[model samples]
Target: MLAEERLAVILETVQQKRSVKVSELCNLLNASVSTVRRDISTLAEMGKLTKVHGGAIALSENFAAVEKDMEEKAHLFLKEKQAVAQYAASLLEDGDFVFLDAGTTTENMIGFLPKKDICFVTNGLFHAKKLAQRGFRVYIPGGEIKCSTEAIVGAECACTVARYHFTKSFLGTNGVSVSAGFSTHDVNEAQIKSAAIENSIQAFLLTDHSKFDQITSVTFAQLSQAQIITDRLPDAKYRSFTTVKEVL
Candidate 1:
């Protein structure tokens, strides 16, 4: 295999296994330890993965640090988002007021929602038109638009979220851990998310399993605030945080 192919395999294996040993990579890639070590060192230097004692691990925190725009995010974990959205929509009933957090996962909710009388209050600028097109009552507060996430955040948006109490709220987060709860990289976005959870009757956090055990810059709400709706759990270590609804 070429050097590039070897590097790609190493990264993929590290991501799939979260962490990988030098021996494992040697056997998997049919490469010598020195060659695998060089690949891991190069990837580590490029900030693609974290180099460990004997191997490398995918650095989710590093990925979380450099935030991706909505267009980039929408394509990731598509099937998992679909499953979570379907399950989230199932929790909705007729005549319920909801807050849909600005995220690719929560954006999928509208497509899965039951055809019923429901009103949506969202900070997701990208979500408004789609919700309106679907014949649901959609409300987006006027605030400064966040270019990266296409979210309306800051004090004005937080105030808007606070004014109305939602029957149920579905939120998305960068990280959801027992210690840090729901966290994101942006503080301005965090304020709005925290407000939505506070003003809602029931809060649900939608995230993929990758979010577990990783924390971002700003923590929005505590783990106890929202019931987690995820595709799967890496382990039962998250039991103390909240009730987890695993779609798997």
Candidate 2:
């Protein structure tokens, strides 16, 4: 294929999939590795895509700044969230002190939680109720509830989270980027999530493939601060910073 045609195909694939490996692009373009790499570089220079280690990612788009309602978010990527949540829930053991972040994926985890002697500390009103109803000991921090996302967030929440060191923490993020790290749209929510991760022995981020390469307003932690459990990892370079468990 001509260079222009090859570049067009490469851009389209990255835009559609959010990321694409150079080898995969080569096969799609019927071009050699060098040709593909050169085309990628050209596109990268044109600011059409981001060139990473062995692949390219789509240019980051501005996702909605306002948080979605819990019901709206619950239906998106439901299968993927279930997979990631189930895997996260399985990691729990008896006598573990867990910090479960306020999000749909973390909420999904409550159903799959093993009937272990696990204690959960959460800032999610619904999460606390669910965990309690499921016969697990659960605690909720004192804070103002953010109605849009149904998350308890404020200085009080962050302060309470800082006082307790957890055995494990399962967090959710609006975006995950190599540069900006794990981010969310709300500063209050970010503060609480940061406090939880900082006071935990091990922190895990429960995210799906769509979050990769995206960035949000506030960064709670760096890429090295937490391991990731996702349904799919769109880029291999994320592995360079921390462990990523792709359940799919």
Candidate 3:
């Protein structure tokens, strides 16, 4: 295979297994040990992997080193998130079936929820408990736990979410633009969010003002698929793509 093909295979294997020794990659890729080492070194320099003493680990596994964690994100744009989430929670009424996405902004919605009968299906590991505590019947998907985002992701999450139909869906995003639509840092988590949108009667994407114009690793849905809920609309260009609910 070509050099590019070999490099892609090596990266995919490491990401799938989380870590891979040089000797295992050499056998799997059918390449020389020296070539595999060189590829690992190149990927490490590019921040795709972390080269250890004898192997390499996927960079995504060390998410905190690259991006802020849940606690850190909780303090950012606190008022804006609360305002937007409060409005989102207000949309909930008795017997409404909904989705509460996994993110700091969506997490804020739990606090602002009114005393109403609602059933929630969520991939947010922490969100399930909070919603249940508020007397909302909550269901979580069976899936792999993504510690970085405090979410349950992968195919199992998508399958579980697909089985239910929602009246309304509240989602979170890392980036929004007219061209790229809604994006997030992880593909697995993105799949779950996309599935939620697909199965909802009305889809609402919630994000802070800061996420505007910023694109992340994966685009989960088209801008036309959901209405945008945020603190402020930074750019007029997005108006052509989707409706924006500017809380401020």
Best by TM-score: 2
Q: Give all candidates' CA lDDT scores.
A: 0.87, 0.90, 0.84
TM-score between candidate 3 and the true structure: 0.73
Ordered list by TM-score, greatest first: 2, 1, 3
- Pairs of residues clashing in candidate 3: none
Clashing pairs in 1: none
Candidate 3, 180-236: lDDT as tens digits: 578787889888989999999999999887887565667799899999988999877
User: Distance from true position, residue 35, model 2, in Å?
Assistant: 37
Q: What is the TM-score (0 to 1) of candidate 2?
A: 0.77
Model 3 global lDDT (CA atoms, 0 to 1): 0.84
- Quote each prediction's TM-score: 0.75, 0.77, 0.73
Better of 1 and 3 by TM-score: 1
| Tens-digit lDDT track of model 1 for 1-248 | 99999988888887776667899999998989999999999999988898865777677533356677888988999999999999999999998999999999999988888989999999988799899998999999878899889889889989888999899999999987554568899989999999989998899999998888776677799888889999999868677767998997
Q: What RMSD value applies to candidate 1?
A: 10.1
- lDDT assessment of candidate 2: 0.90
